[model samples]
Target: MENRGAKPENVEIGLGKESFGVTNLQDHNIHTEPELGLDIMRHSAAHLLAAAVLELWPDAKFGIGPTIRDGFYYDFDLSFSLTPDLLEQIEKKMKELQKQRLPYEQSEVPIDEAIALMEEAGQSYKTELLHDLKTKGTTAVVKGLDDPNVFKTGMETVTLYRLGNFVDLCRGPHMEHSAQTGFFKLTSVSGAYWRGDEKNKQLQRIYGTSFETKADLKEYLARKEEAKKRDHRCLGEELKIFTFSEEIGAGLPLWLPNGTIIRHELEKLAMEEERKDGYQRVATPHLTKADLYYRSGHLPYYREDMYEPINIEGQEYFLKPMNCPHHHHIYSAEPRSYRDLPVRLAEYGTVYRFEQSGSLNGILRTRGFVQNDAHIYCTEDQAKDEFLRVMQLHERFYRLFGIKNFYMRLSLPDMDRLNKFVDDSESWTKALKIIKAAMEESGLPYVEAAGEAAFYGPKVDFQIESVMGTEYTMSTNQLDFLAAKRFNLEYVGSDGQKHPVYVIHRAPLGSHERFIAFLLEHYAGKMPVWLAPEQVSIIPIAERNYEYAKKIHDLLFSADVPTAFGGVRVQVNHSNESMQKRIRAATMKKIPYMLVVGDREQESGSVSVRTRSGVDLKSMPVEAFLERITKELKTRQDLPVE
Candidate 1:
């Protein structure tokens, strides 16, 4: 049984009123039927997990166990610490419980009676939560709230899921029995604070995912294995692309020589592309006055992610966490005419944000990173076309990199939750319509996310699910009329009247680091010819043929094909090692091509080509081989046969 919320409607009026809030509360009724098959199975599996845990650890106190995207996690307060071995044991016990085919019995209980039962069972955590709920008067709030009400005033009766002697406080629509949860795996264990508040006591979080079939579980595990092989951190280390140093801080990555080559290449491509698209590049300081962020409203909503301010001459300055505020200042830098109305400012700017230590996973999520950021200042009439152009750019970049599985997300404000949205509903509605029209005209698949829009305006977020079943927002194209107004950015219209220019904030490739990481996994580290660090490696048969191999390396390197020389001495010991061993070493590096030079080839003024797949081409003229490689590099070919 899937627990779903009400689908939001396209309300006719603008979302401008302060009283306007999120719609579709009726859709998420607990009594409603489930829409997603996997959701119900996963929720039921959580109950099985609780049952297994209770059988093993009789005193284990349970916290919230809910189904999340791709998985479910249950928090437990235990006398003994849980470990990976214990997770395996729990999985074993869960399988046993599944064999029993126990039924899930859901029961509704009053707040007072539930507290007494939990207290009798020595569930201190649940009892404490019950007391806190009563102290905060949540029961009265839930009881008083109506279906259309966005916020509840008092708590209502709570539901509990009972499996034999084990019971958990949950609002669940679980499957009928544990046997219905066909395939499951316990993935990881971590620490999580109660209620997501850092001040609260941390609880042990066990994360596991469930599926409807063993085949589905196998496929999921296979994808995870593929993801592991393609992990950017592992690839980066093996390729000597980048590294992190203790001295350089936790979130900062130090790019090595080969890694810098790829980084600079990507930046060069972005600079030329954006320049051709009529963007004027500009550089900004890494740190700026705190007032700048305050004016941009980032201080009000996102200050927690920002670093502590530095006091410079009694004035506070902060390392910028975003490039928009600085670019806004650039827009306000000088007086502008109507002809300069569509001013596009672009930057490969690096910004800093304080990500939680647990959240940081290599360069994918870093504290300091560069963004392929650009802001287009245009008239309101041009907003639609401008947004479409940004979307086009995103498509062009992704297409060039062969990224096909992605969708656009139209994020709009939830007017019902007025506190979560920016003040003006009319502007949001207008911007939403413009973005929606642009997306529709472009023939792109998109879904609207209520309450997910930026504070200043609505946005279209490009989303992709990774091999690990984790979803990531890859790129964004946002429409911002409010930021223009807030920054007082204006241009004289044809009628000689000052009008605020609309802003289209777009980033196609996102950040170089993140894009490369995704590409690394997408291609499984076998990068396309043009992007590979070492496209070709020339291997000499013996020490005697080193000179000829050097000549070939120089020829390939001069042609701008990234090539390296591997001497026989590096791998050969006397006559014991086979040529196949040396070739396998080169193949392990995922080098696209390997040219094996020997006395026969040197005498013929030609080279023997061994593609990464071990296909050998007889001695060919130097110019002929060079042309083939040059063509492959230019076309960004990945296939060895090509």
Candidate 2:
């Protein structure tokens, strides 16, 4: 062991103690422990990936390689295209070097020296980045400063990592040695722009994942396979529920007839529940003047998430990205008395948010979505009660969907990081206290997170992890005292004086697009009977039983069960296909039940009931089958079928 040159005196290891205001790193307990420390190892593995690429292809140029949530990726510019077979070659070289356990050595170089080295290597992208840093006010790296031997007019000292003669400029807290990166696999290769700017040249990006043990890697791969089977995009297409077209643009889903049926059912359920909860249904325009956003502070802070304003007769208008401001205007439409202190306004509002193209994944992340949105206008004394009611509503709905593995997230602001939160500190504190109290009274398990609150208030977000081990925000209940003040919303108090009102913004179902997509995966496309697009299917054993099948279809259709008849193509089982083939077709469509009719069943005045799980209920009265389905539909039960 050579000891790696006395550990390089100016290592600069560990998070900045002063910036985080922590005198002792151990006290905060925020050090990169085993899991995150292993991530650093994987990041070093990414560098190894790039090093192998450069060794194999001498002219290859580097872009960036960073560890993501569960994996790492590196972008490269190569003379030849990369394929799966090529990735194996790269992996072979990486393992060869890993076996050597090469030391990752760091070195500081002068500005001109670094530039000349990269230029000779034809790394023009790095040169351009260096020049951009110089244009900014960075004076740490200079052209020719001799005494301190440091770059005085560019990015602070450029750090380079060298492993067995392969060098890369990086800001590293890498693994101590290459051998630490274990149980790694190269997953895929795709094209990406340099630094995510579309105008930049496209580079080939290689994605890989690493774990501390082989078992972890195997578990990750198994979860990935499970997620693939549950992907809503594939399920939606197979079930003929939704489709996307290039002509309709990306992120806009075109719902087929079956999909629309599901959407309408969800809307109906929400509307009924909200009406019972004393909510007043209202509708708002999809677009509003830009001045409206200015009044709500959205124009200045949230404009990036909104589409660019449209100019009309010297006035700017924008498609609404949220429904709160519009609902605020509706609340202010007339003078309010103390009796109307807790007015609940609800809407299935459609909104448009500008999501990055790379972020869009079917309906889960879309440009346009409809939120099951509502806002409660209440007095300060009613804030806690209102929040509690919202939480109860959320729990009730989750129970309906059999979602039990979720918890509350109390999102509060970082008082020390003022820029990360709204300027009104007192209001934020009050809102945070009220939400915390509500969560406690509701008796729900919750975890607090700093810097996760909304700009207008503190919030309690409901989070659920998907089958793929990815966390998603299911719904949110936010308390706001600032929005009321900003919009000048006030009501007469008991003393007959006008006082600012409090607001609670809630979305129990979040966005319809995202929730449906989650349910599609969570249930593996086997939707609950009530939510199933095609609840029942009618099949005739032969063409001779066609009349009986049509009668059964009409009867079920009249009973409000979604049923359709399978025609001659599905009826004729004489060809290569068997009865199992027909049943498999219905199962693949996720039809909750199938009614198989033949002369025997027709003469007996009963139907052969077959459930989605391949259970053959020999012969049951049509009335009995309808009764069971009706009960399940009305109660919205997650029934265990035979």
Candidate 3:
């Protein structure tokens, strides 16, 4: 598929396939080259994975296998739980099949024949898939919107791929032979619901990665190992940043004291920045009447993510999943004129979403979290400037956090699937044009994505790469043209007529929980001096130096660093453990600086400074040490870890 050792030819990489009585392939193919991409190789790798699984467990009924970002996975209803040892055995089997040079051949037949083939193989999932394809078109059936009663006749031919004795229902342009599947390795396995429905049976999903070359695979594995070490769930506990409790239920994080400090620091920074940007702070209730959500159209569009409603005094109330609708009410509470355009409302509001437990990953995703949210209500003429300002605000925060590798994703609607988005083509067009103009004016790197916009409008989502090269979606700034009409939001223009205003929804800092999670993994627990919960640890060498340590700690605890909201955080370690052990404990907590106070330091009024990275700054006066750390905190600089 990668064409590593083969010449190019017209391979139908873009043309439609003759399958399921479907005439003419769809034009959604974005690529038209014979040089198939790595995704093609990865897709074949999934088939190989399924083939190996079937070899080990003959009765294993497999589900669909798809290519993810850098890898592939196949779901199987196995008779036994999969383990790391089993993964090795399956991998060995895949290599054996590869050596056999089994050719991948495609076959086309009627739907009933395909169904019979799956029935003989005892693949209920594949049989069910065939039934759906027979009744619904390719798109609706794949998305699980099939209606068995509404079957379409006269077009029942389907396609399948065969590898030796293993035949699978697939629309594939796989490698010519199994040997073409280059370097691959099974990474891990997890439980996934059949078709991602929690009500359905849970199946074993095996994950793996493949590359065109061994070196590429090796490099990817190394990066993956680095990510494993920096995983927020593990690092959060090891560093005592945060933890989850069984008593508190799943998908909820209990922020420890150190984690609280990080959240507070982030909140203070956001508040200061928003204040300078002319944003007025506001607060709203956590839950409101269900009628409000119905009015906002969230009930129809986002009901799945919301928790069940609470019946209060014969009325139903729901937890707020977002702050947009509430802020709209705030805007409508009072009359406004042309002079009052661009109403900037900011809040650190806590919102709730019923995220599936299996998808939860520590604080990166949770049930309840506070969002650093804001909405700008401005006139049509000021919408462009307001959007540009929001982009600039995001850049400022990114620069402050040393997030250098990021790009904006322009998300727009798909006209083909208008059911998912607002049925207002005029608004969609205007919103897309305005956001694109703002992005172009800013000269920031960005890429376009289709069918990923909010239900009501287009948006720009920020995708950031951590220092470890792991990328994630960070935050978004959306332009809404429908909400004003939905909420009857209006302002008096200079002509004294009521005119609708545009709304710009933005959450530059996203949520405190997720942002702190990103910051934790991004820094590898070595937070900047300004954000470190315990900035300096005073480790006295002996009992006599305890008093001196306390004095130095009190000095730092009281001194306020410039540009920092609070005083420097310093703790004196008067533990009975050995001096080196105390220093090591402090380092393990990721304290930026450890000040060793002893006989020489007590007499000279100086401290022996050691960094968490084990750098010995030698002996310096206590005042000098204070000045150095103060500068670091004032500048919000990262202490050298290497």
Which candidate gets the maximum TM-score versus the true structure? 2
lDDT agreement with native, every candidate: 0.73, 0.74, 0.79
> What is candidate 2's TM-score against the reference?
0.80
The top-ranked prediction according to lDDT is 3
TM-score ranking, best first? 2, 3, 1
C-alpha root-mean-square deviation, each candidate: 7.0, 8.9, 8.4
Stretches of candidate 2 off by over 4 Å are 1-35, 50-64, 76-81, 105-152, 155-160, 193-203, 299-301, 308-316, 356-359, 415-429, 451-455, 486-488, 492-499, 560-578, 613-618
Give the per-residue lDDT of model 2 (tens digit) for 538-590.
77777777788777776666676422321111122233345567778789888
C-alpha TM-scores of all predictions: 0.76, 0.80, 0.79
Q: Tell me the tens digit of each residue's lDDT in model 1 across 1-642.
A: 221112211111112332123222223323233337878888888888888999999988887788886778888887778889999999999999998878888888887888889999998777776665556544222344453422233344567778867887766788888888869999998998876778988889899998777897898778777777887899889877889998888879888876776676677677767887888999999989988777776675556667999999999999988898788889889977788868999998888877787667778877888888888999888888888888877777777776666678776666765445446767777888898889998897788776655455676767654444444566767788777667899988889888888888887877777877776766677766667666666767787877887777666666654333211111211233456776777788777677777898888878787777667776798788888877765554554573
TM-score result, candidate 1:
0.76
Q: Which runs of model 1 end up more than 4 angstroms from their true locations? A: 1-40, 46-68, 71-97, 104-176, 185-208, 415-433, 465-470, 492-499, 560-579, 613-619, 637-642
Off by over 4 Å in 3: 1-69, 72-173, 189-207, 413-433, 450-457, 493-498, 562-565, 639-642
Q: Comparing 1 and 3 by lDDT, which wins? A: 3
**Model 1 residue 391 CA deviation in Å:** 1.6
**lDDT over C-alpha atoms for residue 44 of model 2:** 91
Q: In model 3, what lDDT does residue 321 have?
A: 84
